[model samples]
Target: MINSVSIVPDFFQRVKTISFPEVIRVFYDEEPRRSKIHCPFHEEKTPSFHIYENGFFCFSCGEKGDSIDFIVKLYNLRPINAAKLIAERFGLPVSNGPLSRQDMLRLARAKAERLREKRLKEAFDNWARLAGQQVRILAEAIRLQLEEKGLDIEEDLLPLVHELPRLEWWANILAEGTGEEKLELFRNKDFRRWFTCKN
Candidate 1:
């Protein structure tokens, strides 16, 4: 019903003007880089999902839809309900009925999922920051081994250069991997060990 452009509500047209990135921010930690993020409808390593002025497309999953459709899939809501939720969140002029118990549960679950994802991303960010520092420390440790080592902690870092190739790969994950890939490294026990070593 709402899909028919000519017969759509005036508020629906306004919804088109709503920034998709802003819509994403309502339930996400930040706006996605380059207008893309991991697909909300499916698991993906790369950011194959992109948002545009009127809609979104996930290259990996072949999912495509407008702003309301994005919300429907992201939160697993009915199309009408998704539109109403968008209206309420963006302060658009659309009539939204009282929430059903099921609607409440769906919203609650969506919010909790968003929170869990946010915490995970925050943890990854902290770990990535540490990894970056380790990259610098690895360089310094290699330097100390090659040219300047009178320090007592030199014993722990003597092998830094030898492990350079492997650890550099981990550092590159922080530099270039997708959100999911970056988080994947954070969950790696060995990757955590390198950063925690005395530097």
Candidate 2:
């Protein structure tokens, strides 16, 4: 039998290091929050499988794991699969049991490069999400202001008016804003420029 006790430390350490989202894409659909996705290992219509970022636990079956446990459970794979899967997705190579010090350093460098790319992607997505939210709030505010001023437009006018400044009110607000005021300054370009310059 595999010595679970002896491997626990290594197992957990590897899991901690592996990128969770990349693993989900291998056996599960791209989107995990869909409440269901077609299980690759079986045929079903309702898609009872759900993959979380940290792990996957099928409601239909009790298969679950961090990335390593995931590969093993799904394909009857071993730690080798765990290493290979991570390396393949991350574009690193599996480690040979016997490596010279130079080879070991190369593996470490590859792993680090993979990790940095993952982090950059995550940060970009987060920035996009936040930026999108700010744009939405600004659009809503402009719509309300235009309506209040009796400046009505058809649906087609949305694109044209979105980029126009109704007034510099948001900028003025930001100029003397408290902490909350500064946080909401994304709606105003002048304020954004001012803040950027000031900083």
Q: For model 1, how does the per-residue alpha-carbon lDDT over 105-190 read when each residue is reduced to its tens digit?
A: 66667667767867876876776777767775676567666565545445766576567777677767777666777767767788
Worst 10 residues of 2 by lDDT: 190-199
Clashing pairs for model 2 are: none
In terms of lDDT, model 2 sits at 0.56
- The regions of model 1 sitting more than 4 angstroms off are 1-33, 36-65, 68-96, 147-158, 197-199
Candidate 2's residue-wise lDDT over 1-199, tens digit each? 5564565556446544755666665445434436445665567777777766676666776555667776776677776656566655554434423457765677788679767866865664454345444545665676676687545666565653666463244434433433344445544575455333221
What candidate 2 gets wrong by more than 4 Å, as runs, is: 1-22, 25-31, 34-38, 42-55, 65-69, 72-99, 150-199
TM-score for candidate 1, please give it. 0.51
User: For model 1, what is the error of residue 124's alpha carbon versus the real structure, in angstroms, after optimal superposition?
Assistant: 2.2
What local distance difference test score does each model get?
A: 0.70, 0.56
